[model samples]
Target: MKKYKYPSVLTIAGFDGSGGAGIQADIKTTSALGCFSTSVLTALPVQNTRGVRKIYPIPIEAVADQIRAILEDIVPDAIKIGMVHTPQLVETIVSTLSGYKKIPVVFDPVMVATSGHRLIEEETIKAITEKLFPIADVITPNMDEAAILADMKVVSLDDLYTAGKKIKQLGCKNILLKGGHQETPIITSLFYDEDGHYHSFESSKLNTNNTHGSGCTLSSAIAAYIAQGKTLYDAVSLGQQYIYQAIENGMDVQTGSGNGPLNHFFNPQKLIKNEMV
Candidate 1:
């Protein structure tokens, strides 16, 4: 008899040679959450903890090939998407992922980097809005990204809800509007559901420069929990808690001269329990 394999999650994102964000961080977070992770690199970036130097987007056909290979052998329990450089790439991803409606898809709208660089082209944003937004199970966008989606400034919590509602019009079933830009003592995140209800998760903002992968980590955690049969609300809540704790744990670790990566392995819970225990 064969033993059961752990749930597998697929991350479609960029590659960070610094290993602090993108595919590297997604793999770390998913593995820490006790899920197997497979990734398809979207962009190869010349970056460090400080900032991005250059980005090279992969050909669309290569991206499709990677996705096809993964789905053929190991059907993913969940999928997390990030950083597609062009409208064409976004179209390709949506076309490929549309058939996988059985699995949850967590889309993170990564517009700007922590160092204030634009990650996606203007035309690609239009593509994401028109082609992919309607199909995502949940779309996670920070205040800045939310503002871009809403075509207005999201200056306060009230604005976040407005932005979320407007984003839902673009077609996501749910929206997780992140409040990391609010500059408050507490970091607040809002989850707006399809039925017009909203939920909030708040935690004390840790003072640190080690937040390179917080959004990717949170979105992937949500995917992992959903793969394990948790509801969207529960997944987002628990995912936020996991990220907050990881950020707190790694607040002091100086990974590079600039920002650092979160501590993905600070406390990992294994899926298989020891019989002796």
Candidate 2:
């Protein structure tokens, strides 16, 4: 008999009843990438593809308890964080993971939803920058989020470059500034690291409305690859490829009336099991 353990990724985020984003998207992406997935719900949002109506944040103690329980038994190889809606929640998460500095933490500064709903409080944004940014191995912020974090209107490539530099100065070791909002045929995502090095990934923008969970999916994909021991650069590149394919595959599939989710399991992997003699 043989038993094998799979690489694991823990996602600390909100729960979207819509299942297109947040913990749901993170779990789907992690599992699709062949990593075992665990999650801690930070908030529960009454949301669908159309929009988010209300958000119920989980108690700080409960959030802390979930992380402690998981770390005591199955410490994750990597972690993905999203949607911390308050300063207290940010402090709770930072405190919980501070002991495990070796684990790669991919933080998606989820300040706003795809449907233009604000997700985080104004003070929470400040807390994420001050508390979580320094500890994050990589922070993925889309155009809107980058704008808020950088305190600038990011409307052009030069603006993205400037914003990336500014965000790196704010204690983040690595930054992936997503350029999906650019009104262009190609989406150019920028990657800036602590060594003053930058890389650009350009992909043809898919003409689709089903991009509700793309940001969450990308961050989790990166975490999954990192959990499998991929370099930060490789993880970002591979994660981008994975999200691109998911979007392309899901472009035509209708999930809801508004923006829908990516086909996360577009290319699914078979689960491995232990055999007993």
Candidate 3:
């Protein structure tokens, strides 16, 4: 007889009490993708479909304690990190994760707002650049975040290559520059692998305000697939497909007034079983 377990992903993110984004969305995504989800809350943002009003930061030590607790028990196959807002938190996560260096880490650099405002202070950005970027297996940054990381304007598809290379030079193993923020009808995402090859993924942009947690959902899906032994390229490709369906399926469904959320459970998957050898 053989024992079995579900593939798991540990999401380190903020709390979205609305259950649309942050850890809530992460959990929904991983669950739908047939992976067990664990989480560490870094901040509690008082947000809804409208917008984020206030963000209460979790203490640095408390955040670290949560990470350590998860790492010690029911360990994850992959880690998805989102919304580390402060310098000290960044350092603490980096230091704690340092001991367990081999796990695959997917980082969604979540500070750049939809309107292109740099959300965090300068020093926090510095810590993320210097400490966190190096450890991430892949960093999924939107055009706005990429512009900030690469120190250049990423206004066109042509700029994604240059910006990705520039950010890649910052020491991250891979970059997935998402073009969903573009005003164009067709959105294309460029994945720059660790080997320096660029793979392109495109989808027709659906017109909808229900895209609140799309980023969190996409990154979580990628981590879930990675936990299930998908290759980096495959994980990203599948993630794009999953998010596209989620958005398309829920485009007309009303959830809130401002920006609503994707349909994470439009097609839920059964928990995947892995043999415990």
TM-scores for all candidates?
A: 0.95, 0.96, 0.96
TM-score of 3: 0.96
lDDT of 2 by residue, 57-78 (tens): 7889999999998888888889
Most accurate candidate by lDDT:
2
Clashing pairs in 2: none
List per-candidate RMSD values in Å.
2.8, 2.2, 1.3
Give the per-residue lDDT digits (tens) of candidate 1, residues 1-277.
3447677789999988888889999999988898889999888988999999999879999999898888888888899998887988998888887655557789999888877778878888889988777778899999889988999999888898888888888877899998877777887889989888888888887888898978888899999888777888999999988998999999988999988999999998675321221
| Residue 33 displacement (Å), model 3 | 0.4
Worst 10 residues of 2 by lDDT: 268-277
Query: TM-score of model 2 relative to the true fold?
Result: 0.96
Q: How many clashes (backbone atoms < 3 Å, residues ≥3 apart in a chain or on different chains) does model 2 have?
A: 0
What lDDT, from 0 to 1, does candidate 2 have?
A: 0.91
**Clash count (model 3, backbone only):** 0
Q: Write the per-residue lDDT of candidate 3 for residues 76-95, one digit (tens) a residue.
A: 99999998889988998999
Q: List the residue pairs that clash in candidate 3.
A: none
